[model samples]
Target: MELHVVSHPLVDHKLTVLRDKNTPSATFRELVTEIVMLEAYEATRDILVEDKPIETPVAPMVGKQLAAPRPIIVPILRAGLGMLDGMAKMIPTAEVGFLGMKRDEETLNIITYANRLPDNLSGRHVFLVDPMLATGGTMIDAIHYLAERGAREITCIDILAAPEGLKRLEQEVDPSINFKVVVAAVDDHLNEKAYIVPGLGDAGDRLYGVVD
Candidate 1:
């Protein structure tokens, strides 16, 4: 697994606001969309494209277009839903899918309660979006779920990640599965309660308010 941290003055500026507990849900939602759009630029650098012959107003020319078997964007439910619009706007032609997964606070184990994706994702590129990578259990399980269905290449987009989570991903995931993680920042570590420290707290709560 490869990791890419996007470093930009704009990203840093927005992230600071996102980290503030005082930021309202409306503003937080908007910031999440903006940051994801910026990160999508770097995450899709190697996306498959093919040259297409086209006739310009003055002359015939060749331009590039996304290749066949359009990529699929899968957001890991709840918090992940906050990132869907930004990613969809970046690649309007890409297909969309959903995977509902939640981490058991006590066990840190991932529980997949919903799945709405193609039965066969053979050779199709997948982009998995989630706001945070805390313990990495949810992500690791999500990757395995995709791989089981024949997805070989996947790109994971996250707003923040913890070193412990990233390390867990590296040590636990299959070597054969090709995947990369793109994030705005990598925080210091996961606190005892398994939350990224100095990180934006409970992305879902920030974006949609707390749930009982």
Candidate 2:
């Protein structure tokens, strides 16, 4: 349960635009992509790689490439879908997966409505993408599902996180999960209704213009 706050200037710049209520959906979408790319850069610092010998016109040299057992990227849908393009721009060869989840309005519980992932993620480096980690329900359920499939090394990437959510994840989940949470900003608190206070509202709605 390690935490990595991306403090780069470019990340901050992108976040400022994204947090604006006036930013159009088109621009907001692009900014989210850029920010995710920056955060993914940090989250994937320890990605496994192997050396391979290669010959160039100038000289022969050895370089590093992704190790066997290709990495997997799972984005919690619908808002998570907005981040897919950004992530794919970096790891084009990685396998893509999707997990559809929603938070129950009344009980604030996470509900998994759909999942489309390979059977065995064993020995795979998985990156879980979700724009907002306000209450931690969706992320908790997501990690549990991935773990059930044999994914041991996992990283959760988000644009924003609430303190309550981050605390709950650390206290409730085991540290050995090899989980690293990379976010641009950790907000102050969660509202009684489980929404992040002064946080970006309804990531799915903002990203896709859906009310439900």
Candidate 3:
């Protein structure tokens, strides 16, 4: 399990606004979107590409294009939905999938209610987008879910993560699984309720203003 804590100035700036408890719902949502887009830049660093040479206005130039079997972007539903547009804006040719995972509040265990990804994902690169990685249950399940379907590579992107969650994932999850995480900031720990301490808080709620 590899981890990347994005240190870009732009990401930090946006994250600062996001961490502010006083940030309103509208502004928080927008900031989260921006931070995800920035993190996606690092998350997709190794995305498959094919080199192509073309004649430019000045001279011949070489470039690369997304390789065949374009990467698939799977946003674990609800909070993950907020990251889709930001990722798509960067990788327009990438295929999009959906995974709806719910965590049992009492047990803090994850349950997959829905998945619409390709059945034969062999040799396909998959990026799982979830705003917060608090306990790692959803992401752990998400990676295994895609791997079960033959995904070649998997990367998890989040705006914030908890150290306890990251460590638990490293120790408990299978080492044979080639996985990496790209996040804006890794917080100190998880509260009793399993929320990242001083985290943006209920990313879905902040984004959509819906309470249950």
Candidate 4:
């Protein structure tokens, strides 16, 4: 499990705005997009590319192109939907998929009611986008589900993560899985309700207002 924290000055600036309770939903949504776009730069650093022959005006030359089996971006629904545009902008050719996963508030377990991804992800790289990694249940279940469908490589992108959640994922996840986590920041710990402390509150609510 490779972990990367994007440490750019601009990432820090936008994250500060996001953490402020007064920042409106409209601003919060846009900032999340921009900040994730910056995170995408580091998240896709080693994307595979192949050299292809090309003609540049007068001479024949070889240029690199993203390899076949283009990566797929899967956003865990609703809140994750808010993150789609930014990641799409970063990898325009990447296919988009949807995974609707919600956490049971009482049990802190994940429920998946919808999935629109390819049946076989044998050689495809998957990027799972969700704004927060709190208790890690949502992500852990999501990863296991994708891997069950043959997704050999998976990367999870989050705006903020709680150390408790990250540690839980590290300790309990399937050891054979090839996975990585990328985030703007990892907060101190999880609160009683499983929310990240000092983290942006209810990312979905902050972005799209409350949903029943």
Candidate 5:
């Protein structure tokens, strides 16, 4: 698995605000969109494109276009939903899918409660979006789920990640699979309770309110 941490002034500035506990949900949602859009720019650097001949006002020329077999954007439920709009803005033509997963706080295991995706993803390029990568269980399982359905390549986009989680991903996931992770920042570590230290608290709660 390859990891790319976006480094830009705008990304840094927005992230600081995002980390503030005082930021309101409305602002949090907006910043999430903006940051994701910026991250998407870097994340899609190697996106498949093909040359097509088109006539401009002056002359005919070849320009690049996204290749066929449209890429699919799959957002892990709840917190992941906050990133959908930004990714969609970046790749409007791409298809959208959903995977509902959560980490069992007690067992620290991933539970896949829902899935709505293509039955045969034989050659699809999938972009999995989620706000955080805390322990990596949810992501590891999500990747396996996509791989099982025949996805050829998968890119995970997150706002923040912990070293523990990233390491877990490296040690646990299949090396043969084409996988990559793009995030705004990699925080210090996961605390005893499994929360990322000095990291933005529960992204879902920040974006939407706390749920009972």
Candidate 6:
């Protein structure tokens, strides 16, 4: 798995606030979107583009546009949905998919509650958006699911990551797959409860208030 941790002043600024425990839901949600846009810019650095010939008001010029087998954006439910608008704004034409998965608190196993994706992702470039990559069970499941569907390449966008989850991708998962992770920050170790230390708390709860 390829790993890229974005380094930008703006990203640093927003993440600092995001890490604050007192940050409100409304602000946290807004910062997630803002920070994602910056990270997405780096995540798509190698995105395929083709030359386009066009005439400007002054003269003719060649431009670039995203090539076909248009990219797909798969947001991993609830919290991930917070990042959809920001990513879609970057690639407006990119198709959207949804994966609703939850992890068991006790066993840390993943459960797939919903899925809305193309049957044949053969040759498709998929972008899976999730805010935090802690234990990585959910991400591992998502990667296998997309890989089985023939997704040629997958780029996971996360706001934060932990060493444990990143290692899981390296040791437990197939290393040859065309997969990469772009995150705003990779924080300290995970606590006993499996939460990323110094993380922005539960992303889903932070983005959308705590639930029963």
What TM-scores do the predictions have? 0.98, 0.97, 0.95, 0.97, 0.98, 0.97
- The regions of model 5 sitting more than 4 angstroms off are none
Better of 5 and 6 by lDDT: 5
Q: Which pairs of residues have clashing backbones in candidate 2?
A: none
> Which parts of model 4 are misplaced by more than 4 Å?
none
Which residue pairs in candidate 6 collide?
Answer: none
Better structure of 4 and 5 per lDDT: 5
Model 2 over residues 34-140: C-alpha lDDT tens digits?
99889888988999999999999999999999997999999998899999999999999899999999888998988899889998999999999999999898898
Every candidate's lDDT: 0.95, 0.89, 0.88, 0.92, 0.95, 0.92
Task: Report the lDDT tens digits of candidate 3 across residue range 75-155.
Answer: 998889988888888888999999999899999989899989888999999999999999889888888888888888999
Cα lDDT for residue 184, model 3?
93
> In model 3, which residue pairs have backbone atoms overlapping below 3 Å?
none
Question: What is the model-wide C-alpha lDDT for candidate 4?
Answer: 0.92
Consecutive 10-residue window with the lowest summed lDDT within model 6: 169-178
List ranges where model 2 is wrong by over 4 Å: none
lDDT of 1 by residue, 164-187 (tens): 999999999999999999999999
**Global local distance difference test of model 6:** 0.92
Instruction: Please give the distance, in angstroms, between residue 36's alpha carbon in candidate 1 and its true position after superposition.
Output: 0.6
